[model samples]
Target: MSSDRRDFVLTAGKLLVLTAPAAAYLEAVETGKAEEPAYKMAEHYWGMIVDVDKCIGCGNCVRACKTENDVPVEPYFFRTWVERYHVAEGAEHPDVDSPDGGYSGFPEKYAAGDGAKSFFVPKLCNQCAHSPCTQVCPVGATFESPDGAVLVDKSYCLGCRYCVQACPYGCRFIDPRTKTVDKCNLCYHRITKGLTTACCESCPTGARQLVDLKDPKDPVHDFLRDHKIQVLKPQLATGAKVYYNGLDGSVR
Candidate 1:
């Protein structure tokens, strides 16, 4: 095998070994041999590649996510949201807005002769390998899955807000209705059932594409191996799973 392929297999093997105990425990529970609760084994590593160049800021994704997740109407608990970054050439200040929590049906405004262009960036939990939210959760409410997805056990959350503060991206938030900390799980429910996430499915421009990195034949895995990709806040060493292709320099 090629060196790259060998390295990938080695890494995958290590991850499998690390998750063996959890898998066994979950199997026992599923068979009624244990009383403890555990997440079901994920056979694939979920990944998303967003092409910022194709994003149109249509807000369809935001609306779909809210409706699918049954998010509260007031103080919206957005599983995904968009950020508008306006940068002017040689200007000291730039305007930022997420009108109507990013569900506003309107075009973005741009200044005339602006030195730099403005763009809308969609934001969500990165589901990092070294997730700050999971590490700081005193009650083990937040956790990282073997497939690199970050999740929360809402029942175990103590509402301490430690995870919220620990997240540098400001993705986690306390749900007003549940009073528990919440963030994106990458639509775990839909994914496990072999369905696309509501947000991804609703995207009109097809800017969001979900793939399983575990399968070498998958387009996303091939793309990541062959092309350049950028991760959000990579300097923080979070090992984020979500990657952006054709990302703007101002997207950080």
Candidate 2:
């Protein structure tokens, strides 16, 4: 392991000892010590449910993600990205934002009355079960956590663009300032601290849900079992954890 990783491990060990309750410290220590040397391969598979029925394309989630993450104002480094799908009565390949992230308003572009037919679909890192980004990382810089969240070790990343190319969803990108591969970590830092991801918390329509599939009691899991959901690009066989309950077929 690199010196930085060693330091991180040491720091984490100390932090656990200091923060763990007195009654749980010993158990925590044992678990931490006995744990695999590498990052835990997540036991559960996580997925998301996007309720297109509830989404009004308000862009609240997008704005919230930007403000929370301190992401550059440039039209890049998007932790959550939105796409407007303009499906005419019954047509495919409807006009889109031309990859520049520009789109007309709902009522004006799709007609106020017909807005129901044309809707926007926001996309983000799917956090796949069999993630292509994980498979392509030569240094194991990108990995899945025990909670089934995909993340990148920016410190270890070589910036080869392998993960960027491997992602079928086109979610990964290289950070121009850091010169490293960067993408949505699902706000792992915030979630681990008992907080919802910025996108999920900011979503005014409650369309996006960050769920723990391991816990059957989780509302998201129940919703998935209860509703008709769609997985993006399942053909690539990444075992995508993100599921869209009301995704229009044209979104693939």
Candidate 3:
């Protein structure tokens, strides 16, 4: 199954590189003959926004991400996951848990009479502008793309876990099959062709949105300006791009 999956990816990559949409970019990178690169790094800046108030913890996003990306089937391995935060009344901290990486949905842990407010928080790579993961790579295998996406060059990667270690969000992981670090890249193959990431596409509640900060006409500009947003671990100052709305103060 893994071999077949890898073959599919290989075929898809080749087809993508040769297709009309990416032909010029391929020529520029592979042959250095194109007058201009097809996808300019400066033309786009990508990010995501999550409305905590809208998330339902249905597991659609998690399931879609794993299937779309061919992620391994293990509780510990996830490109994107969801955490169920149960904030007890008058408590300083919330109880957080993600069973099976929230792949199969959650059982009711709190009752209506439990006096706890429960919400779901989806988690993934922040794609930070000043990412600590990018800073710690011994090799340039992991890089922040010119278009503001954090991507990995699997061919150049040495299977080191430095990038994984430096990530504060617990986003990166070393793939047992490939022996290489892996994580979400906002579904670059899809996004470059004007498609949304799998998680965003599959979210049932419209809780997630792919945001483009560089486009003046993009709705993301207005959304950011209007909403009171927060990023995880602002104290680390990684310049995280993922924004959260209606985030509970008890969230870690």
Candidate 4:
């Protein structure tokens, strides 16, 4: 490990001990000692659910995520963005657009009662069980956490865009500042501390929810069982963990 990696591991260990009551989990290759680690990888499995019916095209989630994660305000660096779809009656494909990643909310593109239905679909890293990005990463900088969140170790990242190209959702991007491939991590640092993701916290109508599928009390279980849900690209068999309710056929 490099000096930066060593320092990070040491800092994480210190934070872990100070926040024990939170039951947070964060593991690194090594710091200095072989003593017992604080993280319990098996204790949780993380995921998210987006309710299309609840999203109002308000752009609150997008703005909150950008601010909280320090994602670049530029168009190409979105860790999470909302797409607005306008599906005409009996149309084969919807006119989809996410101008500036919908950071400033969507403008009135189509008039009301214009023979088209409009809705918003938020997009992010799927945290796939069989992620192509993770497979193609040569340095193993991008990895699937034991708790199921796909994360990146910037220190170990080689700044290769393989993971960026591998993602079908267009979620991964090269951070100009770090030159490291970046994507949604479900706010791993916050979630591990028992707090919800910034996006979820900012959603005005509960459009997004950060859930731990492994937790019986997480409510995602019943949400999945109770709702008619679908993954973004189920045909690829990515084992994507992000679920969506009322997903439209027009979304691409």
What TM-score would every model get versus the actual structure? 0.79, 0.77, 0.85, 0.84
Best-to-worst order by lDDT is 3, 4, 1, 2
Worst 10 residues of 2 by lDDT: 98-107
- For model 3, residues 1-252, the per-residue Cα lDDT tens digits are 999999999999999777976776776779767644376668999999999999989989899999999999888899999999988889888899999878999988778778888989999999999999999998889888888899999999998799988999999999999999999999998888788999999998899999888989888888888999999999999999999999888876
lDDT of candidate 4 over 128-222, digit per residue (tens): 98998999999999989999999999999999799989988888999999988889999998988778999999998999999999899988999
| Number of clashes recorded per candidate | 1, 0, 0, 0
lDDT of 1 by residue, 10-60 (tens): 999999897989898888878987853343565578878887778888888
- Determine which window of 10 residues in candidate 3 has minimal summed lDDT: 32-41
lDDT at residue 53 of model 1 (Cα atoms): 75
Give the clashing residue pairs of candidate 3, or none.
Answer: none
User: Higher lDDT: candidate 2 or 4?
Assistant: 4
Which candidate should be chosen as best, given lDDT against the real structure? 3
Estimate the TM-score for candidate 1: 0.79
Report the lDDT of model 4 for residue 42.
92
Candidate 3 contains a number of clashing pairs equal to 0
After superposition, candidate 2 runs with Cα above 4 Å error: 1-45, 98-107, 113-116
Of 1 and 2, the candidate ranking higher by lDDT? 1
Per-residue lDDT of model 2, residues 1-252, tens digit only: 699999999999988887757647677677786453443335444557778777767767667776786665577667677777777666756765423332222344556676446667877889887898899999999998767788999899999999999988998888888888888888876766657788789788888988877766788757877998888887888888888888878787
